[model samples]
Target: MTRKLHTLSTVTALFAGLATAHGLPATAEAAPTGQTVAAQDVSPSMLSAMQRDLGLSEEQIHRRLAFEATAARVELRLSQELGSTFGGAWLNEDGSQLIVGVTDEASAALVRLAGAEPRRVARSKAQLDRVMDELDRNAANASASSIHTWYVDLPTNSVVVTAADSVMSKFQAENFIARTSGAKDGTIRVVRSAEAPRPLYDTRGGDAYYPGNARCSIGFAVNGGFVTAGHCGGVGTTTSGHNRVAQGTVRGSSFPGNDYGWVQTNGSWASQPWVNNYAGGNDVVSGSSEAGIGASICRSGSTTGKRCGAIQAKNVTVNYSNGPVYGLTQTNVCAEGGDSGGSWLSGNQAQGVTSGGSGNCTSGGTTFFQPLNPILSVYGLSLTTNGGGGGGKGFVSRLNGKCIDVPNSNFSDGVQLQMWDCNGTNAQKFTWVGSTLQIGGKCVDVANASTANGTPIQLVSCNGNRAQDFVLSGAGDLVSYLANKCVDIKDVSSASGAKLHLWDCNGAANQKWDYR
Candidate 1:
């Protein structure tokens, strides 16, 4: 028997549909129901898994992906255009249509014109967010052991307060809601739930590494390592692979308030941009674009392999036996112990890392995950996509201690490079992907592919050319592969805004670089 992986044929097809409808006019209309934008580029195994879990046929999956691609763009535009009046947006159960909520008729018309079905609601998303914030501020001291979770439900345009089934729990939930500052504004609704959420961790699994004596699955590979649930280990904790080989160390971690962590792997291990589908192949991770609520999602774990489901809610707060973890996305997927830190995907887009949930796979369950974007932001990490390298994202500082800056984050072709004081911004962040220095989806290239003594270094589109290949040699030199030349600061200036150029490799302090 072979294991199925989350692999795809080509990663580009996963998000190609998004580009079809980038901008919409005020009089635009939604895509017709059951109509696909183009041919679906999904694998047979993935299609089968989704069909079994979401109860949709191969044709339905294709249609849903196309509609969702357009809806994603519409949602982004309306959210920005209708700021305060925008309530929320979500897809129907089958994902054939997108429904947007608005507090005013004008916004409703805009939503309709933007290709999404618009519904009227009392409170806007901003108002509900404020109420949810208030609830979170008070939750630390609230007497609420029976509360399952609370989140902003897009369809209802209100904050949902899920309480346990006991009468005492209901009374406590009611009191908690009543005491909240904005709960009386009809922004809060209470629902009863019998399930309890907890962190999933076990001591046994095949595709998991040992953090201490506990096993957890790998989330997604970053530049220099992989991410997992923070509860698996603390800072400086060592990990071993499933085969008991020395793997990596926990360089960063955060739990309770937020469950996330990253492991800096040793040179013996190499990070890959694929997730195990456990059926037969690997699913290549192309990007981390977040999927909207009600979209089909799948999770890969050591214990359960791959499980498919739909996203139920976002910005959810789950109370566990240890403490409350906030900002989790709720789902209907089932996961078991040893599945913590596993990867979740919305189509080919990376969703998050599994945190915890309630129930089991045998009789259905509700799970939650820590969204991936925040994890990357917090750790200053860049995702390792297909054919990409892993070395993390940060300032590439030189001998003068200044960073290689992108000059206002402008990615225009032929924009010359400069060295400036590092302020920890995206302009100064660079990642190594297959020996090429990347920033803002562009590559640091040698101008005109010249081998002259003073050829200027510039930013250009990534074309896999020799002009774009660079590596940090063991001697601390930033060497360009074009002609084995070194990137040096012009005039050997230690001042800010010093321009960078290529020169013959020499053991000089001016040509030395460090990624920090």
Candidate 2:
């Protein structure tokens, strides 16, 4: 088979043209435990897409990302702490808080200390997983046409059997559940659904790669190439780029049971730490920290552009017409034909690649993604990230073209930054490493990790705290992720000795920088 990829080069060129563009961190100076960091490098277009699809305001989107980031951390901590007693965790409807399912009062108390609300459940996550495993083992003996899909719904603490919406299908579903061990233990719940899931075929003009005559979206850039849906192509399949140029060949593929594949590109192509925003630009891929259930997630595909919704469930088994695929994450985000293998993200964190689903963006539909980590692990591939090679290094300033300088060339911790004439010296240069800005081995940090207005910017030891994370928005603002505030010159001063601080992002010249 043969395939073609979208033009990431075009995105690069566009960004380069806009660069004539714009443009963090510190402290062990750490954030408060479990505190949610503000959204980083969230593009205007990306935010607009989320607002349109998720019915949220811009402020709401920011708040939700912060809450979701914190919730994911809390979920991870509680899941590890509770172990077998952990029933599972998810975000609330609005994503304002995390709700953990606990099988014991002791576990519930532990969850509370983690700053998550706990709900008592009869079964632990391990027990529910066992039930789901039993059903998966018996899947070959069951009717896939009758049971459209099945998943371990963490919120309900039960294995949800989504059967086809027909009387005969319902009858078969009941029989199938009856014969399963979960039915005997009352751990299964049956529901009717009108879904006929299938792998989306075809791709968008510039964002798709043709696998023979079939088309699918490019997932994410890996060290040597990019990953996509396994169904898109088989191993050793030759491929081309969306520009119709010679591209690469599929190196690994897993379908039916899994839906992920990676292609090994030729030297002509370079993998980038970017996902198409579908707005003629790219969204920076900083890292791949997974988001918790009920958190808002967005997808980028050639066919649909960008779509947003909440994660509905994980560890889902969808019985497509061809076969059953396991370990897919489910979402309310709508997808369509030709949208398969696209990118899925929760805020800037890469989640997975599109698999198969039912419905379209016009109405509403359920979508699934093959989680990214598993793909990377299976193929022994390294994810390309902004911290790796995508970010820039240079003087960063806006007004009067002053540089963000480290006084006296000092590299000591807690040295406040000041504006200076652009002397093209090392002290005036900053390197963007992922979401953080660094100068002289130290990060540009907000003092005490404070998010309050007027918090002075200073030098601090390299740390991955939000206090040191900053993003150069496409519009030129150098904003801090800790509070979504801008790195502003104190009182809009352009003097060589003007101090730097954090303030409300007002799009003023002082808040903007030429760091892109």
Candidate 3:
């Protein structure tokens, strides 16, 4: 059978990404001693979400959850036993073998004895940490954009600095790291990147918090209030909720060194552990359990709602045009302006706050976030959910995380539906209500309730009519209950203007729906 080709970098294809983290450190702190996941305890919703986003079977999801748990324990043991030599650890692409990073033959031997595979590298975690810290210090007084970011690349076992190919002073990045304690004689590589990251900020409106004139998303609700990106505002800055009503005040804020902030809300608003799913539901947060490298992750933002992806790397230092922000976790999830301070959740556990990233949801991109544990520890704040948060959005591609957009925001009655780009706009939003895929409380109806192939789907006032009912098939097809016909992308085109209509289910990509 011919397989559908997809951009593996997308939220829908996060698990399919080929380049796993070969070099990196913990994105969040290690699981508390003796803490490990047991697949039996994994939530059904979380498992279902993994199935939807990663294209894994229920059995695969269950098995991988156990593997992730074991991987976490093995990583912790290697981290403790190997000490500075422990570069990183991740499950191989198939999620079967655990690959550990070691800087010496001795450490590799130790890892092999622990029942894992070990890859050798040049710089130890200690050496890489020192290099990043030095770069951070040097970057403090420098300009932004010259170098987008720098981080320990455990794959190559060095510190990788990112900048556009057009950057004339790319050498400055390498030279800066060279000044680190052992970088001159150690490993530090410079690579060209596509876009420079900036703190997601906007002056417009949406589901966001306001600090004076600046607008940003709420990361996650905590005990006293919520957490967000420090770049949104500074300490003592007053804020307003999405309602524009008096919201809260920034009790503490930090940037450059670390991009994080917390807002203590007023009595008008209280915390809720539930995060609103843009697709149409609320996810219950369970705990702040740390996921291992290469694990699946999702985010929630006021601008994008929710999106999914996998954890790419950790201990990263990002260089925004403003300056360098240290200790960030990276992912391939796309994020846009105004998405900062959003929620990044991994299997119901709050991950981090959206920091900065390059790219839009349309074309795809990379993003970073301030991990939740550090933020929680720093402020002594409690996540509203049973789990914890760093708070960000994938701005993912799930039905709940993404939108089944109308082409170009045009909402004509007969306009053909398209899976364009997802943004927190009314035109792009979709809600599954009762048995219907709804928009603005209108049902996604079949043209005349016809069973004929190629009949268009449109919006109409919802009734109990069976013609408005649909089912998402196991193969990801949105099949109408009216005719057992599948909602398909007309002509199988993935372009922005592709029209959608009912067709026979054939397990095609255009017919597949990922509603996380």
Candidate 4:
């Protein structure tokens, strides 16, 4: 997979645009585009696309264009002198300096000769040297029963060496510290071999049965349900509340490659927009927008409950012990096994679900999560509360008392309803007042908005818009704008096309729909 370099200027512009659209303060500093030059020197289309997508002001665009030109010149000189063996080059996080990585001392010297600053130390190389020196020094003291393992903790910028009880073990630790005295802070803790537990979820706790227990926070609530991380549970899995009271059932789930799911519940469990009740206070769920690396984020889970960290990288692919999952964002937050499906948020906005990570809060580690936007779009689910619950009105029923004509038009249990533009027709004339959209007197709804498109629209006790929005046509079956299809049950029967198709309405029983 190709890794795209994230441009700081683009990120700034995106934030500015979002701020402007949402009436928030524009907190981003404007970036320099590049040096002025001939039109032939730049890719006009690429420049235009950046400006549009990134929402760059003209001055910012021009400045960045100039910066790019100068950087290109610098790149050419460095490449020619250092040859193809040079490692890589990237702009610093501030976009003010260029960092070029060279393979060895020779390449580093060449780069410096080319008028570029070259730092002598490579952390990885320095680490390897320290390790080898320690091993060689301790070889004479090595005993038959010794085990050693080395690992890097990027968050703390430290290297850890785990070893079994032996003379070599003590020697290795002392020698490593002595050789790399200048490399890191001189703080090392020797943990006993048996005390170092492997990092994986131990699903042995009774509290693990709740959604919060699994670390998955609520995204959005639909008519009769809410959506969350699929890895938390599978279809038909029973769920309980933090207090261990029966809450809901996993209506649908998908994991490994895709991480998303939805749950349907009775009225006893009311959905809220609140996330973690940190010792300070309960964190709110605001809205969802993709945040850039270096942006601050907070998470709420059952185990490590609530914590804040910065986003380290986006679109990272992680191979967990369970399986390979793609498009996860890495962070410095600490999470344990039960926290797998927990909520990851930027400020009050929804970000993603905690997938997995190495390390713990005590020692520090890297955690990864699946982004929420794609999951919402794919499954056609909305995040319930922006910051997690309190700010907005609770769930409303999409169908209540309106009008009904066709007998089976009231969807049977276990199907989803879509919204279509209302046309004054009896099928579309439902009054959505409170939590439920009422037609005549009954409530119309979907069993659940599972990704399966053919899920039917049904009538039930009013919940809210989670199942309400509907599109109407003067001469055909009512369509759902949410699902982008017409109201149709699983084909009168559950066969292949028996799954409803949103054909041009011919005013049939399958097409007519009434909220009540």
Candidate 5:
């Protein structure tokens, strides 16, 4: 469920023949072909998940990746060429085309000649920056401001202001914006939002970091440390990792005016270049190449593990009751407590660090992130990449961090499995070779390869068929490739010798399996 699933404003219709277009629609990822799985060099886990959510074909997924990669380069080139006139850029609904925003006709012409559609906007991105600066200067006076945000919507060509309908009066908001130096008619427009945003900070969970007694998730690994939400800590604030080990201290931090901070790691902890998806793979960091608006994006945090959405707005300001944060990027990604300071990425590129937003994961919600470019530039830190890092074997265990096992170490085809203490035995290991869950290279199979519910589960030779395919869902349900039925606990048994079977996924403990 994606929260704040709102688009700034309607723009020109997307290219024809695309399945209906909408903002942050809840959908599943399609299973990628084996060829595409390799050709894209992405974790098959990631691709299959995206295919379920984004409704894209293997070729479309390939093109989206290729498009965003090339668009990053093109955007940088156009930024240099158009300089101050460059307004913004975005991906089309199908993600097959790109639109670059520029101020002047000359810049638009240049963009057209470069093979991208160009649109003229009233204000340049530089002008929007100036306006945002003015908003920051008025931050203190506007602390009690509306729904906590103002940003230039590339499509609307207006600085969109957000206020909670029940809190700040419309009159009060208008007067505040009118007083801001650069905000005038057609310059700033107010919109009502459902909830007031805040810096999502906590110390109650995984990837836990205790900075001033608050927990935060790692944003992304830089040179000496990782970056996170500024609200998580301040200069000299000592922090500890999930293991209760002294990990690092805040080297630089900021909030309200800016929502980013970086910590300097101690020798006890080694920073890795990849973010753990917890959905079955690690997303490698290749570069921080920016993805434009409407570009499909994903996020990783200790709480939700990995969830994705699209960038809804940028260069935005959110006026929290604590203060106001300027230059934050808003998204439809669902984030909850303990997810703040997590990483927002598109493909392998780093985009930003989680800041704050309203709502929850179960009911859907909105989130904001401190864009990475500003933090990197401000701190003079270079991003780390996966080329220098190695990942785990991608095998995981059941809840309690133990193994999903076959009792007695049986290699016979018909043995039922159970969850037991993991000792790193070969029987405890499982690999996703394509979509099959293989233990000792044998696929977890349905009895007689049938799709019927309550069928006994067993191990069989890899057949490259539906019986072998499985999906590791975000909810920890092992859904089958055949009938969409779940791998279930036989007769809802919890003790040893409880046989595993295929049944409906009813959200019961018997149906849930934890993976490390």
Candidate 6:
């Protein structure tokens, strides 16, 4: 099951809805009204699970769950009045108290009426306070002697700390082991290393780039460049080859809030469909299709290199020391500092780019990556094929047969098209002869086959046009003609009037199309 940390403070009302669905009383049900009495009778198994997993004993579990039950009741009543406007609910880290965020004073009053101790604080203020507390705690600590940095797997919510030669480090490692005993876990030992923690970079010989890296495997190459993690390199940063040869420069970068970046290259380097050399074995290049939540995935990085694991969750928002990053996919795959910007693939289909993870390969950990589709659409680049062994014909045929009519109102000729129920119509029939798409016996050509959005798609009488042929390249962006340009939406949109236009395809969500 997928697990996410929801703030009881932000969604106190939502949980109240959940409680009511589960037959619990609303918050207005007072202590003497017997609701509290019912909550006090929580199941023993539930308490036991908390004790075993969270390290809470019976009494602690009882107190926390009882408090949660009361809070949940309060939330239910408030939510009915506030609906989607209700923010969220969360407990203090210690689990001793609860906080509920509301939209306004009136909403806060409703929360208070539901029995919660409502506090008025701006969202930014609350977030800043949390960051300051973390910063203060980190600053007050003078000794690295006793403190050892460990990696935590976001997918599993597990931690792994390396053992040091020092007695203190050894103690810390042992303590962690003991604390995590009797759970689904694994571990490995490695030599103690210093905590000179700097931002992990993909290094070639010597030169450095903020958000672009050299040693990492390219997700998929387009005509101009490729897309990877923004934390790898920032805008205008230059990249070089493994031998420090000039390669590309970062065109865009977004981090601490969104983990994505793209690099425009000088054509000295080319992208391939392959991921992971796998120690000289054949590499795996995945199709653009996304896998289900429980699907398996394998990662190839410069550090941990290669490891396989399962996806734990999608759309997870992680709070890192730098800032909060949203829309990251969490996996059990192991990774390290230099591994950022590596590729994550599922069954030879591209999945995403390595963003960050909490642990190393020695002990089990969780990691996250930026999904590749969005990165492609944002830049209008097409992914190169693995080893130049063009994709299988069967795959292409299947995609064509599944094409469904997307109303022109919903999508234009150049718009990134999605597959819906097939209705056996000319609009749904698309011929993928090579890399172009022919519709209605005419070429559905991008004006210049450019990757930019807002380039209108026009129907031209077919003449074996390259601009008409399209390929669903890496991460679901359609590549067209010899130009290597992609079918793009004028803008990243889902609205009816969003025109379908073509621009140089960079991997971005706006250009990623899904075939059902």
Ranking by TM-score: 1, 2, 5, 3, 6, 4
For model 2, what is the alpha-carbon lDDT of residue 458? Answer: 96
Instruction: Tell me the RMSD of model 3 versus the true structure.
Output: 20.2
Give one digit per residue, the lDDT tens place, for model 3 in 1-516: 011111111211111111111111122223345544233234455555566667777665655554554455446545645677777777665566677888778767666655667898766777777777777778764346567888876666677878667645566665665667646675667788888888887522114778997778777777778877888888989998778999989998998689998889888886776555564666666445566777777776656545667777788888776667888999878788767777776755667788989998888889899987678667855455432232211112233233466666665566666666665555654543334555544557888889889998777666667678664433455767656667877787656555668897676666766543
User: Each candidate's lDDT (Cα)?
Assistant: 0.75, 0.75, 0.65, 0.46, 0.66, 0.49
TM-score of each candidate? Answer: 0.72, 0.70, 0.63, 0.41, 0.64, 0.41
What is model 5's C-alpha RMSD? 18.5
| Residues 113-221 of candidate 2: C-alpha lDDT, one tens digit per residue | 5445789999998999988898888777557778888899988889999988889988888887887788987899998877778888675412677666566768888
lDDT of 4 by residue, 337-433 (tens): 6666566655444677666676777777667777876665555444455312222221211232122332334434433343333323333344322
Best candidate according to TM-score: 1
Count of clashes in candidate 2: 16
Residue 329, model 6: lDDT of 79
- The residue-level lDDT of candidate 3 at 181 comes to 66
Ranking of predictions according to lDDT = 2, 1, 5, 3, 6, 4
TM-score of 6: 0.41
Cα lDDT of model 5 by residue, 338-436, tens digit: 788888777766788988888877888889888886786678565665533221122233433444677787857777766666565556655433345
Alpha-carbon RMSD, each predicted model = 13.4, 12.9, 20.2, 17.6, 18.5, 17.7
Clashes of 1: 18
**Is candidate 1 or 3 superior in TM-score?**
1
**How do the residues 1-516 of candidate 1 rate in per-residue lDDT, one tens digit apiece?**
011011111111112223343221222234455523442345566677888888887766765665565556456545655778888888888776778889888777666555567899988898888888888887865444688788999887778988898988988888888877666677789898778888888522115788877777788888778888888899999999878899999999999889999999999887787777777787767556678888888888877777899899999988776777899999999988777888887766677899998888999889899998788767867787553454234545556888888888898999999988877777776755444677776789999999888999999987867788665543456776555578998988888888999998776777888655
Model 5: lowest-lDDT 10 consecutive positions: 8-17
Reference-based TM-score, model 4? 0.41
